[model samples]
Target: MELYKAAMVLGGVGDALGYRNSRWERCPSGVAILSELKALGGLEGITVSADEWPVSDNTVMHIVTAETLVSDIWSLTDLYREMVKAYVEIVEQIHKRQPDPATIEGCSQLKPDNYLLGWHTPFNKKGSGFGAATKAMCVGMRYWQPEKLDNLVEVSIECGRMTHNHPTGFLGSLCTALFASYAVQRKPVVEWGREMLKVLNAAETYCRKTIRHMAEYQESWFYFETKWQSYLEERGIAQEGQNTPKFPKIYNAEERDQVYREWSSEGVGGRRGHDAPMIAYDALLSVDNNWTELCNHAMFHGGLGGATGSIAGCLYGLLFGMVDVPKGLYLNLEFREKLEELAAKLHKAANEGEAV
Candidate 1:
């Protein structure tokens, strides 16, 4: 079965691999053409384009997340501080590299233009503002520090609002961060997945379905949010029957599904778009007690969508122990072993009831 732990690594792999094939330009008709090549056969038969899917901030953001996980000593305060540090570093680079009088005209979040053209970028707007990482770390820290959960959740969003004002962007980031917090505390991912959906449903109830998370997968620029039918299939979450969306379960698909659907029916329609619970449910559904498959499936999903994919990956990491992860994937990673070792240390610390 796909454990939440393995999903962390697998999600990245899948996101990268899927992006490679589906890259932004590649479509159902054919792959994208980066550059025109001369036709060997008739001009009509010539191959004009190929495929190259490059992940955007979604992939890059995870670098920050992973860094936060490995290097911060698992301290919530340290994690939040470092997360902001990373975001600042990236934004500073963007600011430095930004074309003067940057005419970033669109409302596109996926661009340097957003940083250049957008008014009062987060770096300048908020005092001590971080991204969703703060919330995740903060809120997750809550389980261990229940009295502070509300404060952390609120403050985390305040920080996110410094840059991301949009409901989807802020809430999505917030939710993801909270989930991460849970993982850091070694919470069972399946339970975490269940809780995430519950939060969305509760938020949706009063919001009147005006908002929803559209966890999109991009193959390239311009073309956003690819269809995840096939990718879901490969990971085995494509088959939707049991109420997994509303009622996710690690051991029981039917119970998970039933609970998921029950909660979802009462949820906001718009808020259900990129239903993270779906990915969480998929992680639970894809499991076979193997634990490794969780990360594998999440990485597979990451091929479809990055943030959600990583969440799925992290969940797998949270649920099943990291030892179940494959030797090669961990060994071959860019400091893969380091991530594993850090996680192990954190896990030991958490189990030993030590707070960083």
Candidate 2:
């Protein structure tokens, strides 16, 4: 119960804060659609007024994923169909409104007109955006058991493909989900970090082996492998045949600040799928269970603040549960009650070993 509540609430808080920070010039399509959905009571009676801190597509999709799992709609195909239905409804609402150019551009990629044809028919976006990782908390929370980790990874990939079909996008989503699942299961931070590297290596190896037979995934596979290798090199962990290098545990304030400085300059807060998870992982390692500090450091990264913050928040919330999350963080969250309600439903589902 505590795990479910903490993941939902903390992740939402992070999303709200991140959305608030990023809504300066342009609003994301998910945010715009979710806003309209809220106004029309399409979001389970949850509404965010104009004055409230608006959530991004991250929270919107996170809620959808959570609701789907808690409802026991376990089949991947069925889950994808239901998610597409929800996404199409939001896209329709988005079209009704006078959204900004960025929102329109994002909506164009969703291919709402072709949605009814089949789940695989939509035009897949090639960009490795952070959308997949942002909504992966639910997968981790729902399948936190060690024995369930394989299923968790498979489901995470399926959910990622629903919007972000590329390997880079889905792999980032897998890492985030696996991180959250590991954290929820009380795995040590260092162990999880090493495990994440292994997962990435395995993914890269699989992609390499299958690239000849499956040419479609080549571009994304190459992109992820190259970028991830560069990232590992920058962090001084790249070595010949070193699949799982030991990630340094940032224990001091000075070390944490140095990492933040380095990543901030490297565009850690941008829209890339790879940067946010690494930033989140760094924040988690640096802060040592201080959720507030972790979020603050994550938010300091500007553009990707909310996502980085949300990832860190989800992990921290999972590690410590709700009892330890500072109450002050909850005071001004606009959709706290709605998130709490959803979390309760998820908790009930988990407790009963089936969705009610």
What are the per-residue Cα lDDT tens digits for candidate 1 across 1-356? 12323434444432333234334112111111112212222122222221232333333444444555445354555554554555555543323211111111111222223433322232221111112322233234223344444533543443343345433334444465556556555654444544444454333342233232222211121110121233233343334332233312342423333333332322211112234424444555556345434433332221123333434545455545454544433334333444344444434433454344
What is each predicted model's overall lDDT from 0 to 1? 0.36, 0.60
TM-score for candidate 2, residues paired by index: 0.73
- Stretches off by above 4 angstroms in model 2 are 21-52, 92-117, 121-125, 200-213, 225-268, 322-328, 348-356
Q: Encode model 2's per-residue lDDT on 156-259: one tens digit a residue.
A: 87666566666767777888888887876787665564566666665545445533224556645666556656666655555644544444564343444355
Superposition TM-score, candidate 1 onto the true structure: 0.47
Number of backbone collisions per candidate: 43, 2
**What overall lDDT, based on C-alpha atoms, would model 1 receive against the true structure?**
0.36
Point to the candidate with the largest lDDT. 2
